[model samples]
Target chain A: MSQKSFVWFCLLPLAVVTTAFFLLPMARLVVAGAEGPHGLAGYLAILTEARYRATLINTVLLAAATTVVTLIVATIAGMFLQRHRFPGRAVLIAMLTFPLAFPGVVVGFMIILLAGRQGLIGDLSNRIFGEKFVFAYSIYGLFLGYLYFSIPRVILTIMAAVQKLDVGLEEAARSLGASPWAVQRDVVLPALAPAFVASGAIAFATAMGAFGTAFTLATNIDVLPMLIYTEFTLAANFATSAALSVGLGLITWLILALARSFSGSAVAAAG
Target chain B: MSTAGHGAAVRIEACGKTFADGTRALDPATLDIARGETLVLLGPSGCGKTTMLRIIAGLELPDVGGKVLFDGKDMTSVPIERRNVGMVFQSYALFPNMTVADNIAYGLKIRGVARGERAARVAELVALTNITGLENRRIDQLSGGQRQRVALARAVAIRPGILLLDEPLTALDAALRDRLRSELNRLLRALGITTIYVTHDQAEAMELGDRIVVMRKGAIAQIGTPREVYFAPKDRFVAEFIGAANIVEAPVENGVLILPGGRLPIECGATTANATVMIRPETIRVTEAGEGILSGIVDSVSFIGDRQRLVVSDASSKPLNVDAPNTIQARIGDRIGLSIAPDAVRLLPSEPRD
Candidate 1:
C-alpha cells in the first residue's frame, strides 16, 4: 500500500473506537439535553438546585483537600525516598505505590477495615471516646478513601520527577555555603515545582471523578459522583445525571488545563 | 578586601577514604599547599585527585587517619557549608532555577549578608568576571564559557580561604579550553587565592599550576614545580606521563650504559648495573659526523606545526623518536647519526614498580 493509505489504515481503528466510545456518547448527550422538555433546563438544574450545588461544593472541597494532603505527604515521602539511603527504602516505595494497583472499591474497603467501628484505629477511637467512631459514614470517610488512592498516584509521579532531577544542583548549593535545609528549600524545592503541580492536579482530578470509593463510603455525605449515581438509580433522572457527569468532566478539564499552564511556566522558568 | 601578602595554607595529613562498595577511593594521602600558590593534582581517571579535592572542601570525610588543617587550624570535623571553601565543578553546576546574579549571591545570602551587601558583592563579582551585563540572564541562556566564568565568579565571590576546581575546563572545546585556562591562571594569580585544581591534562597543569602533584592509584607519585617534575622526573611513570620519551633497554658498565645499537654514558646516582635509559624526544638530534652513540636510518618523518618528528630505527629495528625544528630538511630512509648529550640521558632503575 502507499504511505498515505497505510497511515490511514493505522488510524482507522483508533478513529472508529473514539467515535463509538467518546464522540458518539458526547454527541448523544448534547442532543438529548437539547431535546429535553425544557431544552437546556436539565443542564441548568445541576447549577440551580441547592442539593446539586452542595454536591458540587463538596466535590471541589474534597478534591482540593485531597490534593493538598496528598501533595504534602507524597512530596515529603518522595524526597525522603530520594535523598536518604535509609534501610527499607525500596520496600517503602513499593508499598507506597502498591495502592495505585488496587481497585478503588478495594481501597475503600481497606480504609473501612482500618477506620470503621471495629477496625484498628476505629477500635482505639472507640475505646478513647467511649463510643463507636464511624469514620466510614461521613465526608471525612470519603476523604480518607480518596487520600488512600491519591497518595500513591502523587508519590509515584513526584518520585519519578525527583529521581530525574540533577543531583549536582544540590551539591552545588551545599558547596556554596548553603546548609542542608537551605539547599532543599532553595534548589531542590523550586526544581520540583512543576512535578508537584502536575501530580497534585492529577490527584485532584482522580479524586473528583472517583465513584466506587465515594459510593462505598457514602453515609449522609453527598458528593457529586454519589449524587449523580443517586439521580440515575433512585430519582430516575438520567438527563440530570448526564448533566452532572458533563459538569464534573468540564471541571476536571479546567483544573488540568490550569495545572498544565502552571507547569509550563514553571518549566520555562527553570530552563 | 585584605590584599594580604600571604593566603591561607592547607595541610591534609594522611587522609584516606573507602566507599561502602569496598573500593578504596583515597589511601593515606598527605599534602601541604603553601599560601597563595596554585597546586594542580594531575592524574588519570580513578587516581583520587577529585576525591582529594572533595575531602579538602569538606564534602567527604576521610576515614580516621589524619586531619585537614587550614592556616594551622584543624577543620577535619567541619561541614561543607561551614568550611567556607569555594568549588567549581566539572559540570559548571550553575543553578538552572536562578539568574546569574542570584547564583552569585547565593553564598552571600546563605552566609546572612544583608541585602545591600549581597547585592554589592554580586555586582563586584559580575564585574570581576566581565559578565556585568549578563547578571540578569538565566543560566540556561548563557553560553558554556559564560557559565564557566559565572561559576568561577560565584566560587570566588564569598572570598573563600581556598578554591577547589575539579577539571573545570574539560567540558569546553579545545580553543575555549586554552583561552579559559590562561584566563583562569591569570585570575587566580591576581586574586592570590590558594587553589587546588584537579585535571588529567598535563599541558594545563604545566601552564596553570605553581606546583604539580602527579598522582597514581590514589597515591602521590611526585609533587614539585612544573619544571622540576618535567625535567627531573623521579620515576619512570612520571617521565612517561609528563612527556613523550625514548626509553631503551641498557646495561650499565663502568658508569657507561650500553644500548642495543650503541653505548651512552648516563648518571642516575645509583650503582645499578642494569637500567633503562630515558631521553626526551627533543633531546635527540641528527649530527653530520658519526661520532655519536648510535647510527640509524630514518624510518619515518612527519611534520608537526613548528617542528618535525622522525622515528629512527637501528639494525634490530628498535625505533627512537627525534624531534627537530621544522627548519631541518630530513627525509625518510636517510642514514643518520643520532647523538644524545650525556646530561640528557638518565638511567631508570631496573627494579621499577608498575
Candidate 2:
C-alpha cells in the first residue's frame, strides 16, 4: 500500500469501532427520543414537564455543588501534600487517592456504612439527640459519594500542577510586597487555573451522568440518572428514558465545552 | 565607596543557612551593605552567594543567633512580603496570566495605590525599561530579552528601598546579557536603591558592583573593588576566579621572585623563603628573547581578536598564560622574553590547598 492508503488502513479499525459502538447508538438514541406518542415534542417534555425539569435542576445543582466542594478540598490538600514533607506523607497521599480505584456503587455503599441508620453517625446522634441522624438513601448520600470519587481525580491533577509551579513566582510576588493571601490569589491560583478547569469539568460531568451511585441511593432522590433508570427498568418507558439519557449527555457535553472554551483549551475530554 | 551613604543600610549579622536536611549552604558570616550601594555577590555555583542574598531578602531565615537588620530595625523575623524589597529572578518569574502593564502595576495595586496612579507608574517604568509598545503583551509571548526587561520593570515598580536580584540576566543569550548588563547598571545607578545582586559572572560583577564579594565553598573569599580584587587578590582562589592569573609558587629573596625560567622583581618586601605570586596575563609584556627579565618557549598560540594568548612552558612552575597584543609576531616553539612591571606581581597570603 502507498503511504496514504496505509494510513487509512491503520484507521479502519477505529472507524469500524466508532460506527458500531458510538455513532450508531448515539443516532439511534436521538431517533428514539423523538419516537414517542408526542412525536418530536417528546424531547421538549424534558424541560416542559415539572417532574423531569425538577430532576434536571436537581442533577445540575448536585453536580455543581460536587464540583465546587471537590475543587476546594482537593486544591488545599494537593498544595499541602505537594509542598511539605513529613513522615507518612506517602501513605497519606495513597490513602487519599484510594477512591480512584473504586466504582460509584462502592463509593455509595461506603458512604452508607459511615452515615446509614445503623452506621457510626446514626449511633452517635441517636445517643446524643435522641434521634438517628440517618441520611444514607437521600440526595445527600449521593452527593457525598460523588465528592468522594471526584476529589481524588481533581487532587491528582492539582498535585501535578502544584509540583510544576515555580517557587520563584511566589518569591517574586512576596518581594513585590504581596501578602501571603495575595500571593496565593494572584500567582498560585491563576497559574493553576487550567488544572482547576480540566479536573472540575471531569468531576462535574461524572457527577451529572453517574448511574450506579444514584441507583444505590435513589429512594429519596430524583437525580436524572435515577429517573432514567426507573423509567427504563421499572416503568418500561423506553422512549422517555432514552430521551432523558440524551438530555443528560447533552447537558454534560455542553457544560464541558463551555468550560474548555472558558479555560482556553485546558480541559481534556470529560470522563 | 565601600558602602553607599544613602538607601537602606542592611546588616547581616553572622547569618548562615543550614537546611532542614542538615546541609550547610552558608557559613556564619557577617556583612554590612551600605545605603544605595550595588553590592554584587560573586561566586561559582553552590558557593552560597544566592543563599546570602536570600538571607538579606528575607526569603530564607538564618540559623540560630543570626540576625538581619534594615536601617537599624531587626528584619530577621519579618517575612519577605513585609521587607519592602523587590526581586528579579533568573527565570524572570513574570506572571504569565497578566499582561505586561498589569504585571508592572501589580505592586502598586497591592499597595492600594489608585488605578490612575498605578497606570502612571506603569507607564513611567515602561519608558524607563525601553519596552514601549509591549504593555498589552503577555509574558509567554515575549522573547527572553523582552521578558528580562519586563521582570526588571516589574521589580522596580514598587520603588523598593532595597532591590534583590538573583542572576537576573543569566537566562539570556550572551550578547543580550552583555547589553542588559550595562542597561541594568545604569538603571541601578539611577535608582541607587541598595541593590544586592547575586551572579556567577565576573564581568557582570565588575561592570555593576560598587564592591564585589567573591565567595567559594560556602564562605566569602574576598570583598573589594573590582580593581582591588583583580590586582591584589587576598588568596589563590580569588586571584584565579576574578580574572586569568598565573600563580607561581617560587622562592623569594629581597623582593625578587625566583622562577624556573628566570628571577623577576616585585614591589613587595617578601623575605620569605617561598612565596605564592599572582601575575595577571595582560600585565606580562612580551619582549624579544633574552632581553627581558624572564624567558620561556611558546607551546601554543591562540589569536583572540583583541589579543593573542600564548601558553608558554618553562616560564614558571606551571605553563604561563601570557596575553600578548595581537600585533606581536610569535608562533609555537618560539623563544620569548616577558617583562612584567614590579607592581603587577601580587604576593598571595597562602598557596592553593585544593
Candidate 3:
C-alpha cells in the first residue's frame, strides 16, 4: 500500500470511534427532540414561561458578564506576562492557569469555603461590618465561581495570541506620535481583537453550559440545565426533561452561531 | 512650494543602546541627517543600523549617555508622541483593522486635528502615494506594493519633522523592490522630508542615499556621500563591502607597489613598508601584451547580459577579474594583457585580514 493510504488506514479507527461516541449521540438527541410530540413547541417553552424566560435571560447576562470580566483580567495578565520579565513570572503564569485543571465542583466548593457565610472572608466581613454577610448561593456568587474557571481559559488563549503578535506594530504606532495608550488602543487592541472574541466566546459558552458549579452554588436558580435535571429527577417527567434538554441545546447552538458570526468578522478584520 | 535648500535637521550625539539582557546593540555613534535629504544606513545583519533609526524615532531609548537633537532642540526626554516623527517599518506594519484612509489619518486624529483637516490630509497623501481610489479599502484588501504605499502615506500624512524608514523595501520582490525604491526616492524628494533610511542591501543604499553611513558590529565604519564611500573606502571592510574589489598584498618600494605577479604604480603616502592594494574590476583594462603593463592568460569568460566577466591568471596563477563591455570577445583560453590605472589602485592600511 502507498504511504498516504497506510496513514489513512491508521486514522480510520480513531475517526470511527469519535463519530460513534460523540457525534452519533449528539445527532440522536437532536433528531429525537425534533420528532417529539410537541415538535418545536417544546423548545419554545423556554422562551414563553416567565420563570424559564428569566432564567434564560439571566444565564445569557451572567455569561456576558463573566466573559467581560474574564477578558479584562486575562488581557491585562497576558500582556504583562508577555512584555515583562519580573521575578516569579513563570510561577505566576503557572498559578494563573492552575484553575483550568480543577473540576468545576471543586472550584465551587473552594469559593464556598472562602466566601460563604461563616467562611474565611465571610467571618472577616462579619467582624468588620458587625453583620453576617452571605454570598454562597447568590447569582453574584455563581458569577465568581464561573470566573474561577473562565479567567484562566481566557488568559491562556490571550497569552498565546499576545506572544505571537509582532511587536513592530507597536513600535511603528509609537513612532508615529501615538502615546502608549493610543498604541494599545489603536494597534495592540485591534491586533488582539481575534483573541478577545475567541476567548470571550469560549468563556461565555463554558459559563452558559456550566452544570456542576451552578448546581453546587446556586441551587435555587433555575438555569435550563438545572431545570432539566430537576424535571428528570424531582418531578420524574422524562419527556419534559428531554424537551428541556432539547431547548438548552437549541439555545447553546444559537449562542454559538451568534458568537461565530461576530468573531468571524473580528478575525477577518484582525488578519 | 518651499524652496529651502536641503541641510542637516537632526543630529545624534554619541547615541548608545544596551538592552536589559546586557546586549550592547549600539555603541556610541553620532550622525547628522540633513533636512530634505535621504541618509541611508548601510550595514550587514546585526550592525545596529536599525537600532540607530529606532533611537532617532524615540521608539528606543539610548542608554547611559546620548542626546538626540531635532531642529536644535534637545529631545532626549521628549516622548515619541510629542516628538512629531514618522516611521515606516520593514514589515510595513499597516493597521489591519482600519481602511487606507483611517490608517493615514491615525496620526492626525491622535494630534486632535479637525475632521475636515484630517480628511483633506488623508486625501492628499493618498493622492501623493498614488493610492487615491484605495482610501476606503481595508489593509488586507490591498496587495503588497499597495500596502507599502499606504504605509508610506500613513507615515508622511502628518508632515512629521523627521521620517525614518527601516528596510522598507526589503520585504518586496526584486523587480518590485527596484520599482518601489525609485518611487520612494521620488516621493521623499517631492515631499522634501528629512529622511533616514536603513537597509542591509548595498544597491539600495547606493541608489537612494544622498549620504550613506556604513556600520559594522555596533560601530560606524565610514560616513560619506555614495561616491566617496564607494570609490574611496576608508578601510578594507568598507572597500570589499560596498562593491566587489580585488584585494592584493603588495610591498611599497620606491613609490611603486610590487604585487606578487605584477607591479602597479600607486601614489598613496604610506609610511609602512608593506600595504594592501585595492582595485575594482572595472578599473582594470585588458589588451595585448605590449600594450598593457601586466600580461596574463584568460582563465574563464562568462557573459552577464551587458558585460563580459573575464578572469585572468598571472604567472603566480593569481586570478584577477576584469569586466568588459559585451562587445569585447575574449575566449577562456586566450592570452590577455591586464593593466590597472595608477590612480585607480588604492593603498589600504596593512592590518590583519578579516
Candidate 4:
C-alpha cells in the first residue's frame, strides 16, 4: 500500500468506532428531535414551554451553585491539606477522596441517610426542637448529593495545583506588607485560575446531566434529567425527549466552552 | 537618598530556632547591626544563615525569650507584614501573575497609596533600576537579570526600614552573578538601608559586607571585617572557610616555628612545644631554593590568568599552596623557596573539630 493508504488503514478502527457509536447516534437524535408535530420548532419547545423552561432554569441554577460552592470549599481544604502535615493527615485525605469511588445513586442514598425522616439530622432535630426535620426527598437533598461527589473531584485537582504553586510568591507578597487575605486574593487565586476552570467545568457538566441520583431520589424534583426521563418513559414522547436531550447537551457544551475561553483570557492576562 | 537617614538599627538578642521536628536550626546568638550598615551572614547549606535572616525578617520567630529590636523598639512578636521589612529571596520571587509595573506598585497599593503617587513611585524605581521600558512586560517575559532587577526595584520601592536579602543572586549564572554583585553593592550603598545579606559564597560575602559573620553548625564561628576575618580568623573553620589557608602544625622553639622544610620566625608568645599556624597562599613569596625562610619541591603549578598557584610539598605536615605572579616561570618538581612575613602567620589555638 502507498503511504497515504497505509495511514488510512491505521485510522480504520477509529473511523469505524466514531461513525458507529458517535456520529450515527448524534445524527439520529437530531433527526428524531425534528420529527415531532411541531417539526424543528420542537427543539425550541425546551425554552418556550413553561414547565420545560422551569426545569432548565432550575438545573442551570443548581449546577452553577454546585460549581461555585465546590470551588470555595475545595480551595480551602486543598490549601490546608497541601501545606500542613499532621498525624492522621494521610487518612483524612483518603477519607475525603472516598466519595469518588461511589456512584451518584450511592451518594444520594448517603444524603438520605444523613437527612431523611429516620436519619441522623432528623433524630437530632427531634430531640432539640421536638419535631422531625427532613429534606431528603426535596431539591435540597439533590444539591447535597451533588456537593458530596463534586467536592472529591475538585479537591484533588486543587491539591495538585496547590502543590505546583511557588511558595516564594506568597512569601514575597507578605514581605511587601500584604496581609494574608490580600496575598491569597492577588497572587494565589490568579495562579490557580486554570485549575478552577478545568475542575469547575467538570463539576458543572456532571451536575447538569446526572440522572441516577435524581432517579433514586424523589421524582417530583424539577431537574432537566428527571423531566426528560418522564417524557421518554412515562409519556412515551420520543421526539420531545430526544429534543430535550439535544438541548441539554448543547447548553452544557456551550457553557463549558464559554468558561474555557474566559479562563483562557484570564490566564493570559495573569501572565 | 533622603530615605537613607530613615534606616533602622536592628538588634537580635538571644535568638535561636528549633523546628517542630526537633532539629536545631540556629543556636542562641546576639548581634547588633548599626543603622545603614550592611551585614552578610556567610555559611554553607544547613549552616543556619537563612534561619538567622528569617528570624530578623520576622518570618520565623526565634525561640522564647529571644527579642528582635528595631531602633530599641521591641518587634519580636510582630508579624512580617507589620515589620515593614523588605526581602529578596534566592528565587527572586517576582510575581509571575503581574507585570513589572504592577509588581513594583503592589506594596504601595497595599499601603493605600493613591493611584497617581503609586505610578510616580513606580516610574522612579523603574528608572533607578534601569528597567524603564520593560515595566509593562510580564515577569516571565524578562531575562534572569531583568527579573532580578525588578525584584530589587519592588523591594526598594516600599522604602523599607531594613532590607533582608537571602542569597538573592545565587540563582543566576556565574558571570551575571559577578556583575550583579557589584551592582547590588552600589545599590545598597546608595540606599544605605540597614541590610542583612545571606550567602554561602565567600567572595560575595567579602565584596558586599561591611562586616561578615561566618557561621558553622548553627553557631557563629567569627564576625569581623573582611580583612580581619581573612587575615585573623579565630579558628581553623573560619580560616579555611573565608579563604584558602595553609594550616601548619609544628613545634615552636626560641620564637621560631620549626617545620619539615625549614624554620620560620613567629611573633606570638607561644612557648608550647607544638602549635598551629595559618598562612595565606598569596602571602607566601616564591624565591630561590635555600634562600627564603622555608624551601620545598614544587609538586604542581596551575597558571591562572592573574596569578600562578603552586603546591609545594615537604614544606610542612601537608603541602603548602603559594600564589605567585603569573609572570614567574616555575615547573613541577622544581625546588622553590617560600618566604612568609612574620605578621602574615597567625597563631591559632588548637580546637577539636565537630
Candidate 5:
C-alpha cells in the first residue's frame, strides 16, 4: 500500500469506534427526541414548557455562578500559592488539588458530611442555638459541591498562568507610577485572560452537566440533569428526556462556543 | 512638546542588599550621580550591579541604615511607584494588552491626566522615540528594537525625575545592539535626565556612561570615568575588566622591573621586592626582533580587522598580548620585540592571590 493508504488504514479502528459508539448514538438520540407523542415540538417544548424552562434557567445560572465564584477564589488563591514560598505550601497545594482525584459523588458526600442533617454544622448549630441548621439537600448544597470540585481545576490553570507571568511587567507598571491595584488591573489580569477563558469554560461545562453530585444529593432538585433523570427513570418518558438531554448539551456547548469566540476575538484584537 | 530638563541628582548612601537566603547581593556602597549625568554600573553577571540599580530605583529596599536621596531628600522608605523614577527593564516589559500609544499614555492615565493632555504626551514621546507610525500596534506585533523604543517611550512619557535602565540592549542582536546603543546614548543626552544604567558589556559602559562604576563580587572595585577606568585602573581587577590587560608579576630592583625577556624601567612610585604591574595590549608596540624594551617569540597572531593581536611568550612569566597595527606583519614562532613606555606600565597593589 502507498503511504497515504497506510495512514488511512491505521485510522480505521478509531474511525470504526467513533462511528459505532459516538455518531450512531448521537444520531439515535436526535431521532428518538422527535419520536415521542409531541414529535418535533418536543424540542421546542424544552423552551416553551414552564417546568423545563425553569430548570434550564436554574442550571445555566448555577453554572455561571460556579464559574464566576471559582474564578475569583481560584485567581486569588493561585496567585498567592504561586508567588509566595513558605513551609507547608507544597502540602497545602496537594491538599487543595486532592479534589481532582474525586468524582462528583464523593464531593457531594463530603458536603453532606459538613452541612447535612446530623452533620457537623447541624450538630454544632443544634448545640449552640438549640435548633439544627441543615442545607445539604438544597440547591445551596449542590452549588457548594460544584464549587468544591471546580476550584481545583480552575486554580491549577490560574497557577500555571501566574507562574509564566513576567515579573518585569509588574516592576514596569510600578515604575510607571501604578498602584498595586492598578498594576493588577492593567497588566496581570490581561495577561491571564486566556487562562481565565479556558478554565472558566471547563468549570461552566462541568457545573452544567454534573449529574453524580445531584444524584447523590436530593432527587427533587430542579436542575436539568436531575429533571432529565426523573423524566427518564421515574416517568419513563424517553422522548422528552432525550430532547432535554440534547437541549442541555446544546446549551452548554453553545455557551462554551460563545466564550471561545469572544476570547478568540479578544486575543486577536489585543495583538 | 515640553523639553524642560527635569533631572535630579541622586545619592545612594551605605546601600547593601542581603537577600532572604543570606546571599549578599550588594555590599554597602555609597555613590552620587550629578544632575543630567549618566552613571553606569558595569560588572560581570552576579556582581551586584543590578542590585545597586534596584536600590536606587526603589525596586529593592536596602538593608537598615541605608538611604537613597533625591536632590538631598531622603527617600529610603519610598516605594518605586511614589519615587517618580522611570525604569526600562532588559525584557522591554511593554504591556502586551495595550497598543503602543496606550502603553505610553498608561502612566498619564494613572496620574489622572486629562485625555487631551495624555494624547499630546503620547504623541510627543512617539515622535521622540521615532515610533510614530506604530502607535496603534500591539507590543507582540513589534520587533525587538521597536519594543525597546516603545518601552523607553512609555517610561519617559511621565516626565520622571530619574531614568533607570537594566541591560536594555542585551536582549537584541549584536548589530542591532550596537546601533541602538549609539541611538540610546544620543537619546539619553537629549533627555538630559539623571540616568543609572546597568550592563555587563564594557563597550556599552564606555560608550554610554559619563562615569562607570566597576563592581566585582558584591563590591565596588572602582568608580571613575570610562577613560580613567580604562587607562588608570586602580587595581588589577578594574584593569582587566574595562579592557584587555597583561598582568606581569616580577621583582623590581631599584627603578626597573625584572622580566624574563628583559628589564623595563617603571615610573610608578616605590614598589616592593615582588611587584604586580598592568600593561594594556594596545600599549605594547611591535617592532623588530630584540629591538625594543622587551623581546620574545610570537606564540600566535590573530588578525582582527583594525588591529592584529599577538601573543608573545618568553617575554614574561605569562604570555604577553600585544595589539599591533594591522599594517604590521607578524607570524607565529617568529622573534618579535615589543616597545612599552614606562608611564604606560601601571603598578597595582599586590592582592594576595586566592
Candidate 6:
C-alpha cells in the first residue's frame, strides 16, 4: 500500500472505535436528555430542579474536598517516603498503593466495615464512650471511600515527582538562609505544582463520576452519581440521568481546566 | 561591598567523613583558610574534594572529634542555614519557578529585608554579575552561562561570610568555561569572601585559587600556591595531575641526574636513591641536534595554536613532552636536542619502582 493509505489504515481502528463507542453513545445520550416529558427543558432541569441541583452541588463539593485533602495527605506522605530510608518502607509503600487495584465498590465496602452501624468504629465508640457512632451510609462515608482510592493514585504521582526533585535545590535554599519550612513552602511546593495539578485532576474527575462507592453506601448519600443511578434504574427516569451524566462530565472537565490554568499562571509567575 | 575585607576565617580541624554506607569519602585533615582567602579543593572525581567543601559549608557533618571553627566560634553543629554561608551548586540549582530577580532577592527576603531594599540589592547583584536586563527572565529561558551568573549573583546578594562553589563552571562548554573562570576569579577578588571552591579542572584551580589544596583518594596530597604546586609537586600524582609533566625515573649521582639521552644537573631533591624527576613541557627548550645536554628522535608534533608540542623519545624511559615555540620547524622522525635549567627538573620525594 501507499504511505498515505497505510497511515489511514493505521487510523482506521481509532476512527471506528470513536464513532461507534464514543460519538454514537454521546449523541444518543444528548438526544435522550432532550426527549423527556419537558423536552429540552429536561436537560436544564439538571440546574433548575431543586433535587438535581442539590445533588450536583453535593457531588462537586465532595469531589473538591476529596481532591484537596488527598493532595495534602499524599504530598506529605510521598515527600517523607521519597526522602527517607528505613526498614519496612518498601512494605509500607506497597500497602499504601494497594488500594489502586481496588474497585470503588470494594472501597465503599471497606469504609462500611470500618464505620458502619455494626462495624469497628461503632463497636469501639460504644465500648469507649457508651454511644455508638456510625456514618457508613452517609455522604461522609462516600467521601471516605473516595479518599481511600484517590490517595493511592495521587500519592504515587507525588512520590515520583519528589524523587525527581534535586536535593541541591533544597541545600541551595537552606544556604540562602531559608528555614526548613521555607524551603518546602517556597522551593519544594512550587516545584511540585505541576504534579499536584496532574494528579489532583485525576482524583477530582474520579470522585465526580464514581458510582459504585456511592451506590454501595447510598442510604443518606445524594451525589450526582447516586442520583443518576436511581433515576435510571429505580425511578426509570432515563432523560434526567442522561442529562446528569453530561453535566457531571462537563463540570469535572471545567473544574480541572480551571485548576490547570490557575496553576499554569502560578508557574508562570514563579518562572 | 563593605563586607569585602572582613570575611570569616574558617578552620577545619581533624574533619573526616565516613558515610553510612561505609565509604570513607574523606580522611581526617586540618586546614586553615584566612579571612578573605580563596582556597580551592582541586582533585579528580571521587577524590573527596566536594566532601571537604560540604564539611565547611555545614551540609555534611564530620566524624567524631571533628571541629569547624569560623573566626574562633565553634560552628560544627550549625546547620547550613544558620551557618550564614552562600553555596553555588554544580547544576546551578536556580529556582526554576522564580524570576532571576526573585531568586537573587530570595536570601535577602528570607532575612526579612524590606521589599525596596531587596530590589536594590537584586539590582546591584544583577549589575555585579553582568546579568543586566534579566531581572524578569525565568530560569528556563536562560543560557548555561547566564544561569551560572544568576546563581553567583543570588549567592552573593546576601553578602555571605563565606562562599562555597562546587564545580560551578563544570556544567558549561569549554569556551564558556574559560570565559567564566577569569570572570569568577575577578569576582572572587572583588568580593573577598572567604571562599572554598571545589573543582577537578587544574586550570580553574590555578586561576581562581589563592592557595590550592590538591586532593587524591580522600586525602590532602599537597597544599600551596598554584605556582608552588606546579613547580614543587610532592609526589608523582600531583606532578602528573596539575599539568603535563614528563616523569623521568633516573638515578641521581652527586648533583647530576642520569638519563637515557643525557645527564642533567639538579640542585635539590632525592640525592641518594633512584630519583623520580618531573620536567614541565614548557620548561624544556628544543635546541639543534647534538647542541644541548639531551638529544632524542621526534616522535610526533601537535600544533596548539600558540605553541607546538613535540614528543621526543630516547630522552628518558618515557617519551618527553616538549612544548617548544610555535616558530620552531620540527616534524615527526626528526632528531631534536633538548635543554633545561637545573631548577626546572623537580625531584619528587617518592621514588617509583621499575
Q: Please give the RMSD to the true structure for each candidate, in Å.
A: 2.2, 2.7, 2.5, 2.3, 1.8, 1.5
Predicted candidate 5 versus true structure: per-residue lDDT over B1-354, tens digit per residue: 344466799999999999999999999999999998999999999999999999999989999989999999999999999998999999998888888999999889999999999998888889888898999987788999999999998888888999999999999999999999999999998998989999999999999999999999999999999999998999988988888999999999778999999989989656567899999999998889869989999999999999989999999999999999999889899998988999999999899886
lDDT of 1 by residue, B107-158 (tens): 9888889999999888877877889799899888999899999999898888
DockQ of candidate 3 compared with the true complex: 0.74
lDDT of 2 at B135: 100
- Model 3 lDDT per residue over A1-271, tens place: 9999999999999999999997897777666555546776766767887887898888889888999999998899888888889899999989989998998898889888988876788898888998767787777878898888999888888889998888878877786778888999998988898888778888988888888887887667656677778877898766566766767767777887887787776578887
* Reference interface contacts recovered per candidate: 0.66, 0.76, 0.76, 0.81, 0.79, 0.86
Cα deviation of A52, candidate 1, in Å: 2.5
- Record all residue pairs in model 2 with backbone atoms less than 3 Å apart, i.e. clashing: none
Whichever of 2 and 6 has more TM-score, that candidate is 6
The model with the greatest TM-score is 6
**Candidate 2: stretches off by over 4 Å:** A265-271, B1-6, B269-273
* B164-281: candidate 3 lDDT, tens digit per residue: 8999998889999999989988887777778899999999999889999999999999999999998899989999899888877756777777755566677764545667877889
RMSD in angstroms between candidate 3 and the native structure over all alpha carbons: 2.5
**What tens digits encode model 4's per-residue C-alpha lDDT throughout A1-271?**
9999999999999999999999999999999999999999999999999999999999999999999999999999999999999999999999999999999889888888999879899999999999999998888899989998899999999999999988888989999999999999999999999889999999999999998888788888999999999999999999999999999999999999999897886677554
> Per-residue alpha-carbon lDDT of model 1 for A102-218, expressed as tens digits?
887887788788777667886887779877767786778889888888888888877888888787778788888888889888988888888887788889888888888866666
lDDT of 4 at A143: 91
Candidate 4 Cα lDDT to native? 0.92
- Higher-lDDT candidate of 3 and 6: 6
Best by the DockQ measure: 3
Complex DockQ per candidate: 0.71, 0.57, 0.74, 0.70, 0.71, 0.73
Could you tell me which 10 consecutive residues in candidate 6 chain B have the lowest summed lDDT? B345-354
RMSD of model 4 against the true structure = 2.3
Q: What is the lDDT of residue A116 in candidate 4?
A: 89
